[model samples]
Target: MKIAVAGKGGTGKTLVAGGLAYLLARAGYTTLAIDADSAPNLGFLLGLSSRDEGAIVPVSKNEALIAAKTGTAYPGVYSLNFTVDDVVLKYAVPTPAGVHLLVMGTVASMGAGCTCPANSVIRALLRHLIVDRDEAVVLDMEAGVEHLGRGTAEGVDMMLVISDANRQSLAIAGRIARLAQDAGIPHIALIGNRIVDAGQEQVLRGFAKDRELVVTGMIPFDPAVVRAGIDGNSIATLEGSAALCAIGGILSRIDQEIKERLNGRVDTEKHS
Candidate 1:
């Protein structure tokens, strides 16, 4: 399963992405967690040490590697097709919990102007990871789906738009869902995070119901999560924490959905 997690700043989307990846890895799935955010903090949440995090040079910033894959000469002229199969093996840092992390910093040329070599390399690598890789890939994306082109978005199985109880966060989530839909992403769901009480849950449910959005899961506000973040510790390590338990529930739901889809496909084939 290829999943993309997105949310406005301070929404704890990174935590969710890291937790999901950890869960998949712990379940014996080869998981690749890609940090596609501009200010990538998934590394920290995934329990990478400061030195290890600093050692990771994002694909977008690796000028030499980008040039080698894309082109050397002109700015606009570059190869759009490049092999990125070795990227995971070569660059991905293995965590103690068995998840491989690939930090994809923001695609610089994606802002304005023609696509540059960096953009080509980043896009190609992302496409390869999402479309070709068999492992469970989790992308911790930027606030928006700006990095997701039509082709990349189509390859993703699900897009989880996380939101707090705040109006601005929900608005961003709605915008992200629309963008994902426009880009041909098949499944889009909202994850309510930091939901403190019944009132917050009701607000999220009401928002989803009114907007016709799918609420995949809700995570209760846990002080343990906050402490973990403050202490620069991995929440996944706190196995019995309320937030971790909630994330496990979400992962189970996702796994069940995947199983159902696979079973449906097998049944259809048998009938045919």
Candidate 2:
């Protein structure tokens, strides 16, 4: 299963992505959590550290350089420069948690027509890593759903849209949900975060009602999550805590939904 956790910046999308990876791994799926954001953070969340030992391979594409390499050949004929392995970072990380991470390569500012080449390579590598490798890959993505272009991993099993209790956050969340729809993404669910006040519930319900989106689950405001992120604490190690309990339920729903979707697809194929 390929699941993406995304939302506006600072909405705890990475936290949910990291926690979901941990939970999925614990369930024996051999999960791979990817930090596809240019400025990556899933590493810290998953409790992995590089002693600044390995080079941060810039995954960005220098379209000009690549064009030069192609020597006036058609852009379509220009082969990609980096391999999937070249961009994937194997942090000399030691964790009993049993998961792996890949950082999306990054580069500085560029021209208007230039989208991050690293983004292209990373997206290709992500497709290879998730669909080709068939590993349970979770992408901790940046805010905009624009990252997911057409004819890519548009077939992902789940497109999780994370949001907070604020209106601005919900606005972005709804926008992404529409993006997912435009691509005809198979599954889209919302995870509302920093939840408090019963009124926030109404806002979410209204968004779901107006947009017809799925509220997979809600994560209440929890300081444990804050401490966990700030301290690089392993969420899998949290025991007998409210935050952990909430996470457990969230993970359970993910599992249940994945199972149901897989089963539904299988039955459909059989009938056809």
Candidate 3:
């Protein structure tokens, strides 16, 4: 399953990615969670500390390829010899619940000329690193579909657009859905993060319907989550945390949707 979680800033996209990755791993599936967001909070959420640059791998093509593509003068003798996997790092963090994790480095925002490299880096490797894998991969993408780059939107299986109660966040999520649609991405759903109670749900559901997105689930603004983060604990490892409970519900729905989609595809293949 290739699940990509994207949303406007501060919508808790990274948390959704990390939660699902942790959930699937605990469910006995080997999972790879890629933190493709420019801010890259998954490392912090997962409690991974690394001074080594290896922890944050770069997405540069082979030095030769980069030079060739950019028409840059070669610095010196070089051999083009690294495959995509060579650039990814495995962060093996132990969880009491037996969920395995592997984290990728961050990307800069899709901002200006200075961000061109990060954007290109994300665009280039985004495809091969995602849909071409056997193990389930979850991508935590930046707000909007900027990470989809150009002409490769078909690789994403499903995108969960995160949003808070704020209108700005909701507005951006609608834009994200449109971008995903433009990228030829097939499925999109919405997750409203930081909902205080069910009373706020009326507002959330109305916004979701107005935007033509599904209000899949809601995560409460739990202080336990904050405390867990403060102590450098994995949200996945948060015991008796309300945030985790809500996230688990979200994961269950996602799993069901994946299974139903896969089953439907199998039926289509058989009838054809």
Instruction: Write model 3 residue lDDT over 156-261, tens digit each, in one string.
Output: 6678888888888878888888888777888788888889877677777888798777777888898887777677776556756777778889878877887998
Model 3, CA-based lDDT = 0.67
Query: How high is each candidate's TM-score?
Result: 0.94, 0.80, 0.79
Q: Number of the top candidate by lDDT?
A: 1
Each model's C-alpha lDDT? Answer: 0.86, 0.68, 0.67
Looking at model 3, the pairs that clash are 38-107
lDDT of 2 by residue, 1-272 (tens): 78888898888788788778887888788788876666776665565555321443333434443343333356445455545553334432334567777665453322123444444454566666656667688888776554555555465778899888788898999888887777667789988787776788778878887888988887778877777766767666555556566666887887788898779999999999
178-204, model 1: which lDDT tens digit per residue?
Answer: 887877888888999999899999988
Name the better of 2 and 3 by lDDT. 2
Lowest lDDT block of 10, candidate 3: 77-86
lDDT of model 2 at residue 118? 47
Ranking by TM-score: 1, 2, 3
Q: Which consecutive 10 residues in model 2 have the weakest lDDT in total?
A: 107-116
User: Which of candidates 1 and 2 is the stronger one according to TM-score?
Assistant: 1
Task: Assess candidate 1 and give its TM-score to the true structure.
Answer: 0.94
TM-score of 3: 0.79
